[model samples]
Target: MTGTPGTRTGRVRVLIVDDEPALTEVLSVAVTEAGWHPYPAADGQSALRVARGCAPHAVVLDGMLPDLDGIQVLRRLRYENPELPVLMLTARDALEYRIDGLANGADDYVTKPFSLEEVVLRLRGLLRRSGAERTRADDPVRVLGPLVLTARTREVHRDGAPVTLTAKEFDLLSLLMEHPRQVLSKAQILDHVWSSSFDGGGNLVEVYISSLRRKLDRGRAPMIHTVRGLGYAIRPVEDGR
Candidate 1:
């Protein structure tokens, strides 16, 4: 959807790659309401065709297609526009698949049966951040332990190595890192990372947090913490704990 009166200058264009006509229509309507232009592609080939022609700011891609897989689509897009932001949609819930998506250069992934609002929110955030960096060229990088976030590049690094994070995980990490050692409630996280129309019973945030812990906290100094009966925080691990 478009922002406010003064925020409507250039429209954010999105190319959706999915074989489901019904889902694509629904997404198109939602994206239109959110002030974005939506281009639909029913298969991987069509997706690439549309993407090449439109050169969208972002893409919403499905994992499965009749001809080519989502990974192939991602590969082509990377070849054509390496820096293009992609939001992959898949029904697979397996951790391995999610990891594979990241490994293959997907900017973000949303499982099937998702809320339209969540999708729109993610698109907006990605587009906003993408453009925001150009306007704030002198912003300093944010660091937390091994993690390094560059607002200019919209890139994250862990120990000098590039790390891929979904939109939600990046948002959550940014929030926690902004207030290190401070507890943030689930409600707060929801409000910050998701649109108000999100209605997943808070499970969505938990799922993404688990994903982040696996990717960002494994074998590390345990920066992300859970406060019982309260909320969550990210801080350096105590010497003994």
Candidate 2:
């Protein structure tokens, strides 16, 4: 769908990949009601084909499918379009399963029986953040200690060099930097970075945090820290050593 310039006028394009026909129809109607164009796919192969042709802004993927699994679909999508955001849906609640999905490139995953309003809200948030990033293509780079995130090029740098980050990692870091020194709850992080469809019981956020720490804290002092039972925050190391 076409969007008007300088105004939030266009419908966000969304691809719904689910084997259940009933679920797909319900989701399509919900997405349309939420101001997005929903494209339905009943299997992995069809999803891939539609993704290639539609180039949707984001995808809502179900874990179970007839042919290829959701994680596999996510991997292939990442290979084809690294920046494409995806919200995974599954009935599985196991931590290992959640980690596997995230490792395979899913930005977020929602458990079965999720509310339609929740899903639509999450999609809108993800689309809003994505749209904002596109609009800031000419803005100055944001520096946080040894870390540098360029809004213009969608690039992240460490010290004086470049660093490659998955789409979700960058989004997480961006959200943290935007609220530096302020602790943010896992739910807030998921809503801002992965979309509201996330439902992995905070494990998804933990895994991404671990990945970010490895990349952003290799040689430098740690900046990302967990606040005990509260949440997480990013700031300069306080020891002053």
Candidate 3:
């Protein structure tokens, strides 16, 4: 299950970390069924070793490990690959744990009594996002309403005024504007904007959307609209439809 990055050529390498052998087997089966290559590790140290050697695109990490706590393992993984998308699976059902996981750079979190289907979906979303970002790297510019994004220059302007954004913020805005008026599901936004390798469970997406609204729609008619239970969309707000 271990191979050089890109050596396999058509599938994404995913590191599945869990101390439970049965669960690990089930997850490996699911991952394989979903067309991803799964590399399983039974402990934190082994997880890091596998990750470093193979360079997986994403990781499915269990919260409790025999050697190192899941969070600590995640920290070490992040250090090795800062941008690696990690999904935390834990038996702990606490708000603080989820918050702490997200703060420490986990892209997604799932409780132990979770759906295998959901994990598959999340992983697919992450891969698609990462692929789309790579394919769309050369797309130069996109404009929506009065907002404009120039990918080559890495610049943004709203209503003819310069607007500064962090690199990630700009990428998020670019994705939204690229498909104006279309209601992008949280998964879609997460995949396209955040590189699909990380989910962060919509919180990261929400935070970025809020920041975009504040900076890009200030004193304006509000182009960013939350679609209530769906996701977010960016388009001109009609004056009095």
Error of 3 at 60 (Å): 0.1
TM-score, ranked from best to worst: 3, 1, 2
> Per-residue lDDT for 85-183 in model 1, tens only?
889999998999888887888888889889999999888777776773243234344545445565545566654456688776888888877776788
lDDT for predicted candidate 1 compared with the true structure: 0.73
C-alpha TM-score for every candidate: 0.51, 0.51, 0.52
Worst 10 residues of 2 by lDDT: 1-10
Q: What is the lDDT of residue 112 in candidate 3?
A: 79
What's model 1's TM-score? 0.51
How high is the lDDT of residue 208 in model 3? 91
| Model 3, position 158: C-alpha lDDT score | 57
Tens-digit lDDT track of model 2 for 30-143: 887776667678899988876654456789999989999898899998999888888889999898988999888887778888999888877777767677335433334454
- Runs of candidate 1 exceeding 4 Å displacement: 1-9, 132-241
Clashing pairs in 1: 1-34, 1-35, 2-34, 2-35
